[model samples]
Target: MSDHTIPHIGAAWREVVADLFEMTKPKVVLVMLITVWVGMALTPIGAIPWLAVIAGNIGIAALAGAGAAFNHILDEHIDQKMARTHKRPVATGRISRRAGLSFAGFLSVFGFSVLMIFTNALTAWLTLFSMVGYALVYTAYLKRATPQNIVIGGLAGAMPPLLGWTAITGHVMGLPLLLVLIIFAWTPPHFWALAIHRRDDYARAKIPMMPVTHGIAFTRIQVWLYSWLLLSVSMLPVALGALGGIYALSALLLGARFLQWSYWLLYEKKPDAPWGMFKYSISYLMILFIMMLVDHFTWSWLVSIIFPNI
Candidate 1:
């Protein structure tokens, strides 16, 4: 191969890989995995199944990626009409619709196989359900059909921690449900913040996002309402004794900050970019889950020291 040809080949290969990865929407998958990992770690059970943790991460990432790819394929037309997403691989024709569908199928099959093999059937099934709910239901129908789309579709996105818990515990539990509720409540404010920032993009695409459908004021009020509810829901775990002071304190403080941000978004002078709350919402969930993980280990260590034996 000629030297120039070699660099061309390398560039082509990099572009191909990048397009494929972009179809999966890896940034969203990262937060999903963190929630799953934290849920796995915080399982109150026998010695941690290290294998399940590793396998669960891989499986969840694959399925989440698959679902995102499916979304790309479904939303390509609308994506092209939006400033924020016009350059998506599928939208821009870098990845063909047929190719995107194939990739999504491959990821789903691989993820499902890994989940069934490494974890339990229930975990695999639940993950599959969430993926389908997002890719098929949310992306295809809910997004176009209603302004309340994210609020309802958020259930699918909120399942990760529960998936993680079931991977390790082989059964669902109350605490994991609490995790799901917190995320479900958080998703609205998170998404509505971005929707406010991108309301024009949504309008251009003819998608009925909250800000586009109900107007910015109504959407802003919804963000505040959901953020307040999220703050209350986040405390449920600590209140019920699933978590202790460290986690509870952290949840309260972080949630207070989230509410404060929501307040600014709703009440303060309008800014050029209205995505401040969107950025903080992501960090809020990540840190809140991390606090829960830390609380679990801290409690475990204290118990081991204080009790020493039954």
Candidate 2:
């Protein structure tokens, strides 16, 4: 091919790759992958089966991406109206609705197939429920209908770790359920922080976010309430003897920081305060999960070193 043709072809290929990546909502998928990995690593019975774990991870990630894409599809009109979401692929018209929906369908089928074939039926079914919960119930209905959407819909987001636990053990138990509860409790404060910052955008889009409908003061109070609940929930592993004192200390410190930020967001009226709370909330959850995984592995290492017999 001529030099001019080569550059044209390369540009076209790059666009194609970009469009495909956009369909997967790559950043969100990355978060799902990390949490699932942490869940598998924190299991007490040594390393999980690699093949099943990897297969389940891929399926879960794909399903999450598909749901995000379908959300963009359903919310395209609203997204286009909101400054925060106006530049999304669907909203920008870079990807047609038909193409986006088709991609979503393909991803859902492939992901469900991987889960069923490589993992157990239970994992497969749970994953399917997660997809529907996010794509249909949360995105299509609850998001527009009520300010409590994320609270109800968070069950789907919180399922990844449980899915990972089940994929390894082929059953659910107290520990995995605790992990699920951690994410569930973490969800409201996390998203509410973002909604607090984006209240104007949500209001313009006519979505009934807590801050938009119930007013900022009410939403701020809810953020503080949820933050406290999350802190209590985070201590459960330590209380159950699943973790060591180190984990308890970490939880105390992290939860304190989380509450401090939420408290400021609740009481302060600074222009930058909402943004600060939003950033801190993400860090708060990420660090909490990281500390959990680290505490688990570190405690195990210490026991092995000190005992050297058991």
Candidate 3:
């Protein structure tokens, strides 16, 4: 091939790689990884296994990416009809369904292998269940079946902390379960804000998202209610003595901001309020988990300094 043709071929390959990466929904995968880190970190393991932590996290990310790719294949038709998702790689035919499926299969096998080798059988199995939960159960059935789809489907997305904890301890524990509960309670408000923003797209696609099925006004009320619910659930860790004062204070402050945005979305009804809430919710969850880690590590040291006599 001529030099000019070689450059053109390289550019084409680059574009193809980018498209494949897009199918994995990297942004969502990133959030999953952060929660997983928090889960593993909060475990009471005496010595950290850095190698397993790194390898297992890579495995978890791969599985998450695989699930997202599967979602691209299954939701292509719905994605094509929705303005927000119409330009997705599968929907746009930039990557065919068969290619997407093969990619997902590869990721699933690779991720499961890595987890089993580096982590444990339990972690591997649990991660696989989460993949199936998201890719097959939620994407294929629940999403199209009911307006409460996200509520039920939220468990899959919320499983990373448990998976992370199990990777370290090879079993379930109360703290990890509490972490899962926080995410589960947070999902509705987080998603409903986006659904309200994209209500027209969902309506056009005939997807029964909360705003589409129940009306935006009703969905807004649900968002408001769920925000309070999230705040309440967030306190459970501290109440159970699993977390500390630092995390409790962080939760209250972060949750207050979430409630503030939710309040605006409900009463103020600014056209941009829903989008603002959607954006903030993402940051809120990430920061909340990071604070949990911070609190977990530093609380004893701080208490010792504050009350030297005690």
Tens digits of per-residue lDDT for model 3, 1-310: 7879999999998988999999889999999899999999888777899977987898999999999999999999999998889999999999999988999999999999999998899999999999999999999999999999999999999999999999998999888999999999999899999999999999988889999988998999999999999999999999999898889999999999999999999996576999999999999999999999999879756877998877
lDDT tens digits, residues 1-310, model 1? 7889999999998998899998888888998889998888878777778888888889989999999999999998999998889999999998898888889999999999999999999999999999999999999999999999999999999999999999998998898999999999999999989999999999999999988989999988888899889999999998898899999899889999988888888885547335777888889989999998888899989999999993
lDDT score for residue 229 of model 1: 96
Tens digits of per-residue lDDT for model 2, 1-310: 7879989999987986697678678877777777787777776566558888889898888888889889889999999998888888888988889989998998999999999899888888898898899999999999999999999989988888888877777788787788789889988888888888889899889999999999989988999999899989999989998888877898899899888888888888566777888787767767777887888888888989999999
The number of the candidate with the highest TM-score is 1
Number of clashing residue pairs in every model?
0, 0, 0
Clashes of 1: 0
Q: Which residue pairs show collisions in model 3?
A: none
Which parts of model 3 are misplaced by more than 4 Å? Answer: 300-310
Enumerate residue pairs that collide in model 1.
Answer: none
Among all candidates shown, the one with the greatest lDDT:
3
lDDT at 84, model 3: 88
